[model samples]
Target: MIPSLSEATIRHHTIAQSFERGQGYYRAGSVHSLIQRGDRLLARVEGSEATDYQINVYFDQGGITRATCTCPYDYEGWCKHIVAVLLTCLNQPDRIEHRPALATLLASLNREQLETIVQNIANEQPEWMDAVEVQIALLTQSKTQKSQKAPRRTTVDPKPIERQVKRIINRYVEQWNDEPALDEIREIIQKADKFLEQGDGNNALIILGAIVRAYVQDWMNLDGSSGESGAFFEELDDALTEAILSAELTTSEFQQWQKELKNWQKEVVDYGVDSFEMSLTALQQGWEYPPLQEVLQGNITELGAWEDEAPDFADDLAWIRLKILERQGRHQEYLYLAEAEGQTDRYLQMLTKLGRSQEAIALAEQEMSTAGEAWTLAKTLRQQGELKSALNIAMQGLSLGGSNHYGLAVWASELAEGIDLEIAFQTRLKAFQLQPSLPDYLKLKELAGHRWDSLQPELLDTLRQSSSSLHAKAKAAIFLEEGLIEDAIATVTQLSSYESDIIHPVMDAAIAHRPDWVIENARPRAESIINAAQAQYYHHALNWLRRVRAAYLQLGQQEEWHRHRTALMQTHTRKHKLVAMLQQRDLT
Candidate 1:
């Protein structure tokens, strides 16, 4: 007997929400025709859309071994359809036991019988006929010895692919629907992958190269701040890397690829494309084209002569040369090039790798006249276990104070361990004073530990006097955690401004213990959120309203809740989008 699908298995395949949704789907009789075939359980599940999705689950006594679905839900291993099918199987395992194995029935049929069955299936579903047509043609042709026309050789054009990518980017920019854009990009990448699987590396390269060129061009035109575009470029780089890894190329083929790459580079330069230098660098490094590396090395050697005409190209070649050297374990050569290139990061990395910490420290000290260098040197020293030196360097860096002052404070706190507790506490407090971030405050509290009680009054006084609301929120949170509920409430209520980060926590803490306080306090903030929210951010306001409603429901203040909601609807009558959202959530 096969074991039932466990809750653990459902959670393993998908998230909790999907599993819960699957449960609802199962309960609604959406899963049907569940059949057991060998170790697999198969079913059809009706989805939100009109078409039903096919679900396949491979299982045994241990539980589900594997599952798959035809639904386009790719984030998780198995989709909700699969989960629903599994639930159906677990609930009524006997229903599937009577179903005949499809493969066994197929094996029992004769060749002529199989042909008749195929013909019937083809008649019912014409789309199925395409797969069998080629085999049918081959069989008939052998019997008749008939002549066949030569198939047309279609040329692969990169333009269509490039145009489609550009169109998707433009659509995303106009509407900001990321899911469809990402799906289209992935589909395009799958096309390239199919070409690669068919051993057409050149065409695959062409498709990916076109995408890179288009992305770079678009990045040049855009504001250069859209992280989505950057993510897409990274995905292209990954695809290119995979394509390179999977490619099987001869010496001449590799040389041809190298030529094509150089041509692509030239095209990019001629077009003055910018902001995909890293992508290009990744492609070059991934290619590992031996002849190109050799040529680049030679170019690096003669860079002094070509510096006037092709200085940028010479620099690119030099960087590639350094990468190749590093790959070959030619560290000394890489170090020389790095030093010549004034790449401090690379220089320090090589020094550390070569176990030349003393030289690294000396170089860091020489550079530490600047704040950035001082922080870097201090971090390097700390990592190298020279704690005393690290502390002194951090102090020196703080004294210089040319920005990244928060970094110096963090370093000082980290290095102040086992030295002076008071100094460490002061350093942490200074870090909080500089940034007023929650993490720094948490760190300061942790450092204070048992002494936090003794330090509370002074800390509260300092926070109350501070101009930053972030500090005041931190003080309120500290008070809340310490069980000084009145103090927390008072501190939070005194704030003239309201931020969600400050409001939500305070509301959550007060909701059960002081429902009236939460009701009185959160109403204004929720209204402010609703008033300030744009069409795109109406969902946030709805969420805040939901929380507010939950608090009212808990307090048995349905009348007050209804009145407040009525007022909100009347006040925001012009915001049809927000009103529609509220109606959808049944909040009205």
Candidate 2:
């Protein structure tokens, strides 16, 4: 069911909070629209570029609330776009609306309801009965198309087995949507079975192991049918068990398989510490499968003991496990581990996962004390929609880091955002004084980009007092802020011509101007950046295009703008997607 305007806004706010916490601010910008689809919202934002972002907000079977983003900063499920979208909704609540009551309930169905729903779906959409056939047809078409292509043998240099295994892992990861190489796996298993039939169990064990490795690396291992309990792995896992049982293993072969099994067992245990269960009956029937049962028992017994000890180790373990569980899409397990640890930082981090930042920060401040920690804690506060507290903590953190330190310098840059522009300007002045390096000078200028108008009187006074780099940046900032676009472009173009690394801020400033001067002056540096690229130059070029696009749009030069946009889309669309995501968000 569709989320109410209020619910959607709240969800978006949650995402924005995440964006701020993770430093997801790229080029701050505004949104044009948020199109709704069911519980999902597709938001279009204008920044240095234009792009679509998706947000999903839903309730689980237990009526637990959840939200997620397709944006890159959504590594923790929440991001700045969500927050911006939410804030946008809050300011204009007429954007949100509830789905009709007759529409599908915004909740999961119970077992009986699910059965009824299935019957209803079947009755209305009988094509669901042919789902398997449709899937098979699609697979067959893919294989046929592949077979029609000219085959060329590719050479792969032999590497260490571990390296080969890692390569195999990457191959499967890359082919996440493709079918597993199950035919090859079956071939290996057939060879192993033949060896077993010939009474060569050791050889069979070795071959079977290769088959098992393929399965372990295969993404299909995670798929499960929507049937009985554990229905997902029932077929494939049962086949694996049968293969092990039917094998005629000699003592040596048995020992070798045991060792290999133990390693696989270790990976499983590490990946799923909680909610992994094994039937004691399955273990008792065969010593080979005992490790699964043992691992489960060991974890259960340790849980009680773990609670009585210091929570630090538990927090650390939980942190490590959270990463694993997140990758596995076992989000609930990740949250459970975080809650069990009871560490403020850990809990706050988990709050990001659950989209509960206010609760997270309250807990975080109870224990957070370091400058870095305070900065981080402030981000959580921001995520929870506590803007006042977020700014407060950010100020405190900045003071603790001191003006000369890298942390304060970064904070100064972050504070340049709309809500905290004044604070950003003050902090930037201090930063320039502490470190007069070219980069620092450039950053100070960039921070002053939007603050130029406010700084005009002071900038004139500062120009008279000094002729330092700070004066140049302050002057440039004023020009840009005053909408004297050409003047700002000329200033930075002249400065960047002296040094290439000094090109970034100038490029940014030119883009901010969105003037014809940007296309004229930035062209040379852009070419130089391309010519002198060391792998990292592509990113700079992409940034150049983004800012260039922003400038073009501002100047209303549609034709040249489209040309630049097309070039950007052609050369670095994939590369810039993440950048676009970061920039599109309103981290504040």
Candidate 3:
């Protein structure tokens, strides 16, 4: 069941513009084909692109665990499409069709019904039979041809995949301006990712190898010098490495792959792609390594075996082993390898997952080094109904001298609520001290309550003396939030860059209280943009000039403002779009 979500929760997760746009999308009935598969919500949203974006929102008793969309709107959090689906779930729950989990649904259906369903699906698309046939074989095929550890091989031809990669590369060869049209190649990789995710490693290997062998043979035909093609290879490297690690192989088969990849590695180095180096390392260290085997056998304390800063592939290799173990339900071995590899985050998490809270709590003291490690275990502990220990671990992690994550501290602060309000205040205060932002400032002020008056001066002083390396937005916002007009003015002025973002708010708020400051700052910043003639940022420049106009009007100096505006127009007479846009957007 999807948790009952609120409008406030939706707004909190996404930006204000996205929230408003999502509301519009929902009202316009853009959210379609809404369905509930167990605790997962699926929907298609009609968007600007011709194809509708698909969205999946997962939830449980706690809340919406995660939401994802097919749309390429990767900024900070959930995109407008995801927001619209959540909004629909919140308001129009009746529009959703709930179904049992896929496994349960299949179990309930009779064999004849399932056969009819597959037959109907194949009839809908005749070409799908090629895939359907391969799947059927995999399901019913006996293990007589190979060892039980090896993955079932697909009878699907590699010719079609190779041809697709060639077609995509040749089609986009002429348009190699900045970046090639590698979205199709990326699509091929995504197809392989599905097989790898489902543990069908050999089939994934076939798909990945087809794309790589074809693309590498022809990628140099385009403009590979621009360094854009390197990203494509990097993605290929990750998928290929995962394929290599996931697929169970005989010793002879491993050496054969290593030989092939070595040649491919040599060819790719000239293109400025180093990602394949890790893939090569992975092939060389495939699970038979002695020390790794020792760790898998629960000999964690025996660190004298292989004790150097692990090769760069150590983390990724360890993760693959841990995942394989996890999938096989070998949790104890997972713990052993995780601890031996110094994956404190995973080690403590498994302890919590196994309901050994006392073990987790006790081990956290020695095992938790970074704030990230502590946060992972703390979050797991809190989810499993261990509130006191969660808060304790969160505080311990934050107070650790090495490093701390500001976002986790804020989350920890939220978890601390109803348990110990003072600890919550302290946790939030630590977040602000770590990284001051306007939101954190407001939160701290609100939480301070009666103590705010006493806390205000020190906080303001700290911001004033803060390192210039701190985010400009954070500095400007904190100062403006407190109505410290002079402090806000100084915050923007101290920065080396034309702090227009900081200045825009400062000038708006200071037009009445400090008109002189607004005029002094706005004209130069606006002129710099106009002189550069970038055209895109003209509106931003005009925005600052409007504040200047307002400041002049406030001081009864409209005539001076008019002369300055006229001089600017006279100087840049050739920029017609700039002039027209300025007049149109109320710059007159």
Candidate 4:
């Protein structure tokens, strides 16, 4: 909020207030002048070398003001330019005292001044002049003698940090996009390629690093020319990282890969891990692409001799060995590693999954009281038919995390199967209020799935009065139960643009009813719509063409099936061409 100020003090107090409020917006040039109009302050600050900022500060009579800047930050609210203006008003430009004490001022003079004053005085008296001259000569001789004896200072050249960085990247580029530097990167790439060939991510890090280094290097320069490259790199990097980080690679070779990964220069990204981890995540899904997968899995098993490796490789290799054991269902050996690493959560989850719920819950609850852990415990207890314990776990989770209402509702619904509909509905409603997704809605419907439990009139009214779209979905669900397919379809279709998923269930139900009269009437109408408005319904028409192909095959209509298949093939070709163009753009 801006405060109102008069024309006279517009530049002074108003700008001061802006700075005091921490508005540090600045432009290329300093503030030139300021003026005031009707309830507004106009400030002219020099912008870039070629432009200037003409700002307008609108103020209200009650001492409220808002400034609009011409700079880009103005669009974002509060910028450095505003701060500059405020600084100008504070009147502390040089931040030095205007005056000084006599002794302090005299002390500031250099040795040259002291020498000059003494020499001038000495020249007025013959005896003093001679003495001063002798002293001056001695001083000059001493300076010269000292200067001649001192060793010459040599200047070391500034470290070429930027140039070194560039060279490193250029070499990396040559290695990945052109050649390989150390045998390690090449070996890794080869291993990754082989892994990709086999569709195994046993050596994900190596392949991920190669690709990440390639792309991250390309865009780090930040010149606008690399914008598209940067975007593509970011997307690929994110997907690849996700896949690698999520997949637990548990082999001696994979352990070596981890050891090699630690050698990479550590960098921090958006997530909780370092740059290597970030890169690993960013490129995880990239392995799904066949070409990339090939590049990723080129040299997996060829990595040799871990026993005589660097010290950093030991822990990583050991972890991989443990992961392998876990994958083989060798829980005892895996537990050895977990104990060594102090991984309580891993121990708990494994125990819970292995039907040791009581021990797992006790252990997890001792160290942590998290909703996710509690929820998992509840699920395990429920599965083991410990209703009382499961309910207690659910309550604990709800108390800890306000958002666990859905988990509570789930437990309630399960417990109330044949007992009380009202309790189930109430619990579900609480969850729905907190976070309403499809599953929650489905749970509510399921509570009413078996018997027509008359919802209290108020609850029914409340459902009807809720969101129009949700209400439509509820109505459609009711109609679906009554076997009124058309009505269900109609209710869902009312919000067709928004409720695409709702339509799927309704369509599934409607399509199940193939009464002769209804099918005959609807089939021709759909055909007429497709034929008369083909361009308008191109996507839908394509779907209809597919259905026709299937239906004709069922009816032994070979000619019709052939025609539909040909159309679909043509559409497929066109789609492929567009995809090819997009891929080409990525390479460039």
Candidate 5:
């Protein structure tokens, strides 16, 4: 019923910043395969991550009635990937031309046409062939048995599931060479999802549960030098948790599974708390499993009483109890538990939620001696309309002088809103004097507003006079910001300690205006970086070398470039990897 989406409508639905980022993604050709099926538009968007995220946007008469993406950005209603897809749709409306559903398209194709299409897909993606073959077999069986009544659902065997889990992990470990097997692990989990989609939740749970056992039993003890193995396990844990929550089981079935879990807990060494916590969460969310509840309640009581003997277990148990109490609207019990556990944030949150503002204020004031407490108290005071008190607390925290004083200063300035801009500027300037950081200086300039031009000289003077390394950088930044490229370059070159990152802007500026100077200054640093870089950093060294080459080219100094290349080759003659890398790029 809805009209085709326009760029203006997309802008209306999305925030400006998200829209801009999405536009960049679209321009980069990140969105692809955009198609319309009935009222839905689906596309694949390549994101910052290795995998592409699939986006589905359902439109109705109200424009975009619903949209979902596979990216982990639930905080924003839609992510840049979603925005990219929408922008693609707006820019290329013809791309959303109605495509027949897969079933309909398949039905219309002749046997030879279908066979050719399947053969082509199988050649490109053999994994998809398994599903297709299974479907074909199922169809043949259905046709053969069409005259008979429907058969009972067959149960999936746990042995085959366990074998599949072992096979997947073994293949991943062998092929990935100890790297994180996130993609392989997700592929295995997707098989379980297929079961769930086919109304076999119990089978899905079994598959995920088997994978968890295999991971803990065999995979955890391996040398995870790549650091990806732990992330893989985390993903596995999430899959297991999701399956436990969503899978449906009868009372007897649930009790049997509970028994198996307890048996595993006793048999396995340091059994993971993730599954147990997920079970507790399911109970908290009103899952009507009586035996599971009894088991969890007993464990909670046992762990709660063993606080001194088993502190870790006791803490976990307490968290579960707190979550349950909070969910049940038992604020009094939640408060007592929070206070007992010394959870200040939770205690404060509970107080505020219960409309006990006076008590919350009292607690906030009492906790204001610590930097973290001061910031929290100041924000709470501001929210309570006690601006002066908040400002005083923030100022006191800043005077105490710690790592977090800059944050305190910002909080104080925000509290001083409508009071006095001059006072706010002075406070921020004092913070800059204390820290001499670029961020604080910029904040001070922001508060200066219309008078920033007048204040610029004083700011530059302060930075130039300061002995701090950060202040020196700030001075160079100011020069660059004001477009005094020569001054910026001169200041950076004269610095006693040279950071390659800080020298980059100066090098870039010098390349255009003073190519000779860039060639002279950059050669030694590039040589040092190339010599010191590891195999992984070879690309970074190559990029720096490219910059040096560009500088030489800019000055039309081909002979000097050849001489520099010869010198590098002679100096690093024994570094085979470096020589090969340079020769590949014709740098040697």
Candidate 6:
């Protein structure tokens, strides 16, 4: 069944402009043909295009897990069409026609009927012929074919996949909009992953090798400004590494792969990324590194893969081994490997899973070093139903003061909501002190309730102490939020440079309490723009002028405002555009 959807959920997934725009589309009844098939909502939203766009929203008991639209709206979140469809669902639930899920409908059909349906679909869309062939082959695998060794490898021609990779790279090269291209490339790599998972690592290696070659060839042409390209290359490297580990390679192939991975690792590092370096180690440790075997057999006394020193990718290698063991359902070996290698997260996770909750908790307190580690275990323990323990560890980790304290505090506070008020307040208090943002302070205020008056001064002190430019906006915002108008004025005054966003709010909030300071600050900003003859920026000058006028009027100094306006008009008499703007705004 679909979860309960709300307007807040819809708005959260959409940008403000997109949400408002979607509301317009919904009001115009653009979202039509809405249908709910089990946990999926499918609809066509009429928008500014030749054809209507399709939207699919997938949900479960948790909430809307995914929402997608067949439009080119891939900036950060859901597109307008998706927003409109969800809004329609929330407001007009009766308009949604309910239908059985596709799996349920398919289950009702007999074998012959399913075959006929497949034939019809193939006739209608011949592009699905490949899937049909694969399905047929899978269902008809012979007994001899089924009786294969581990890591059964199958080969594929890399030419087509290589062409697809090159096409994706070329398309994203110009705009540096490599995110969508990365998505497409990752989809291709995921296909190889599926093949590798099914023990057909030969085809997986071919596909992964083709993708890396293409990606490395023209990677420099694409813009990595989004910081996503680095992560994309890492995924490609990881896939190549996994494929190499899984494939049964000839000795020469193994050497070549190791050498090529070293070269790829060198080439891709220009983007400040360390990729394919893992593939090198994977090749070095392929299937039979003696120490790895010893470690797997619960021998921790041996140096084990590194001789008295950890390798560059020791953690990554340990993680990879743990994943392999977990995948093969070798839980005992997984536990031993995790413990032998000091894989605290994996080891504690297994302990919790194995019903050793007290041990996991004790070990978490003693062994976890970073808040990030404790944060992860706290979440794991919470999911494992050790709520009180999770909250306690989170609070303890919060005191450790690592980079993840703010994030862990937030997680712990939410986890403690309706469970323990003091824990919630303490975590949130630490979060606000650590960050000192207005939003955090406000949320802390709500949690502090009657204790806010006592806590308010301490929060305000934190804000006052946040002198970095990074926290300037938040500091000023908290001043305004707390009705500390004079403090808001002082905060804005201290900034050496004017950021209208940080200063303007304080000015607006201080017009009644500190109009003289507003005028003193605003006039200089307005004069700088007007005097510099920046015609394009005259509107900014006008805005500052408007604020100055408001400030003077708030101070009951209208005649003073008139004198300042007339003097400014006379001084910029040659700037006809500026004068005209003043006239247009009735400041003549």
Question: How far off is residue 11 in model 4, in Å?
Answer: 70
Ordering by lDDT: 3, 6, 1, 5, 2, 4
Q: How close is every model to the real structure, measured as TM-score?
A: 0.49, 0.33, 0.75, 0.32, 0.51, 0.67
Candidate 6, residues 133-221, lDDT tens digits: the string is: 87776688654454342455446888888899888878877785767888888898888878865667667888899888878887766
Q: All candidates' lDDT scores? A: 0.63, 0.47, 0.77, 0.46, 0.63, 0.77
Candidate 5 vs. true structure, TM-score: 0.51
Using TM-score as the measure, the top candidate is 3
Q: Which residue pairs come into collision in candidate 1?
A: none
TM-score of 1: 0.49
Number of clashing residue pairs, candidate 2: 10
Between candidates 4 and 5, the one scoring higher on lDDT is: 5
lDDT of 3 by residue, 1-588 (tens): 464365645654677568778999999999999999986888999999999999998764435657899988867778899989988888888999988888888998899999999899989999999898868766775544222344586544668999998887787777655254576688778888778656677788778888888878888766644657767777787778888877877678778778878878888788666657767776776666677677777766646124555776677667766776665467887888888877889988988999999998998898677888888898898778787888799888886655657877876766665467687678778888888776667667666779999998998888888766556678787777778889888878755435555667777998989999888877787888899999988987888788888989999998998788888877888999777866654556
Output candidate 4 Cα RMSD: 36.8
Candidate 1 residue spans exceeding 4 A from truth: 1-4, 100-153, 175-182, 221-226, 241-260, 263-539, 546-588
| Candidate 5: segments with Cα more than 4 A from true spot | 1-212, 226-320, 373-440, 450-479, 483-502, 512-517, 529-537, 553-558, 566-588
Per-residue error (Å), model 3, residue 527: 1.8
Q: Tens digits of per-residue lDDT for model 4 on 1-588?
A: 233121222322233244434333333337756554444555666655468676665544223235567776522334445555544444433331224434565687899997787777877765787676656655665423422211222321223322333454456553233222222233434544444332244244445555545444443432333333233433433434433533445466445545544444343233222345444322232224332233223321212212123233234433443443454455654554444444444556567667787887677667545666566666666556555555566656665653455655555444543345565556666665554433445456555554425643434445445556655765665556556676665565445333544554565565445333223333443455444534544444343333343445445665854664455345445545322332332111
**Cα lDDT tens digits for candidate 5, 1-588:** 224344544543455467788999999999888878776788899887898899998753324546889987745446788888887776777766678767777887899998899899999998998899768855675422432322325666567656765666676654545553545556767987776545355677788777666665666444455756554644554454455544566678677667655554444435433334344344233333443344334433332233244333344444544554554455676676555555565666567567675687677666544556566655665555555665666666665523677666654554454455666677767666656554455566667888888887887776666666665566666677667777677767755324656677667877877887776666666666676756666666666676688788889887888787777777888877877887865564
Give per-residue CA lDDT, model 1, range 1-588, as digits (tens): 244244443544566457778889989989888777776777889887788888877643323546788887867556777778777776766667556668888988999999899889999999988778756765665412321212223447989888988887676665544556666777888988777544455567677877766765664333323335445544665566555434454578567656655555564565443334443444445434443344334433432323234334344445554554554455775776665555565566567557786787677666545566567766666555566666676777776746888767865764574555566677777776776544465566667878877776776666656666656666676666666666667767756543555656776777777877776776666667677866777776776676677778888888887898878778889988877777765564
Give per-candidate clash totals.
0, 10, 0, 47, 0, 0
- Candidate 4 — what's its lDDT? 0.46
